[model samples]
Target: MSIQVGDTLPDVEIRVVSNGIEEGRTGPLFAGRKVVLFAVPGAFTPTCSNRHLPGYVQHLAQFQARGVEVMCLAVNDAYVMQAWAASQNVPPELLMLADGNGNFTKAMGLELDGNAYGMGLRARRFALYAENGVVKALQVEAPGEFRVSTAEAILEALA
Candidate 1:
């Protein structure tokens, strides 16, 4: 089933990079904290690079001030995610997570069919507000739309 509000995030392993590449479980990462996790179809795509990710990056402080940890999740590999982070000059406070094999994306039932685009398996654009591992609010954008998943929308939902 698709994850929804009031559901505990699946305890699936997702990859992240700090001093070096590391793996973290979704449950532990979302535990005991308020988190805003947003996913893009892929890194470096026009909408993702120009808007989705940047929206969160630009308003990062606002999210932090409200005591929320902001994260960007994508189906790309750690190397691609790391390069995108560096190219965008993403702040240390914001985390970029890679669901290398689409394990987490598939687990959440948010995988997009990218076969037509030659991208293979990818994540559908979405965002969620989770507190202590339970989802409080969730937004899944319609294809080719950028409304509900933006930082502004998520912030408003939090309010």
Candidate 2:
């Protein structure tokens, strides 16, 4: 079933670079924290690069101040995620997680069909406020829309 507002996160090893150094076999990234996990269609796509990711990147400090650990998930692999992170000038802290096989995306029930666009599987734009791995607020956008899950909106939820 699709994960909902109160759903606890699945314990999956979503590949992540804990810092710039990269890490181990990977583990559940949100076992004990308040996390703002957002998913995008692809890494480096114009809207995701210009809006989705940067909105989080620029207001990272604001999120931090509110005790939100922001994470970005895309259907690409770790290497691509890392390269894109570097290109976006993301700070060391904002985690870029690779949902390479779309396992987590499917698990969360948010995969999008982009076969016509040649991307195959991807994620819809959405943000969830999770507390200790359970979602508290969920904001999912209709295809091609960006109004509801912006950083400002998530911050409002936090408030």
Top candidate on lDDT is 1
| lDDT, residue 14, candidate 1 | 89
Q: Encode model 2's per-residue lDDT on 1-120: one tens digit a residue.
A: 678988887766567854653532223578778899888999989989989899999889999988889999899988899999999998878988888898888888989999999999
Estimate candidate 2's alpha-carbon lDDT, on a 0 to 1 scale: 0.85
The local lDDT score (0 to 100) that residue 13 gets in candidate 2 is: 55
Q: Write the per-residue lDDT of candidate 1 for residues 1-159, one digit (tens) a residue.
A: 688888888889988854456788888888899999999999999999999999999999999999999989999999999889988878878999999999999988889999999999999999999999898899999998999999999989888
Span of 10 residues, lowest total lDDT, candidate 1: 17-26
- Against the true structure, what is each candidate's TM-score? 0.97, 0.93
lDDT of each: 0.91, 0.85
Clashing pairs in 1: none
Instruction: Look at candidate 2 and tell me the lDDT of residue 29.
Output: 70
lDDT of 1: 0.91
Model 2, position 98: C-alpha lDDT score:
88
TM-score of 2: 0.93
lDDT of 1 at 108: 87
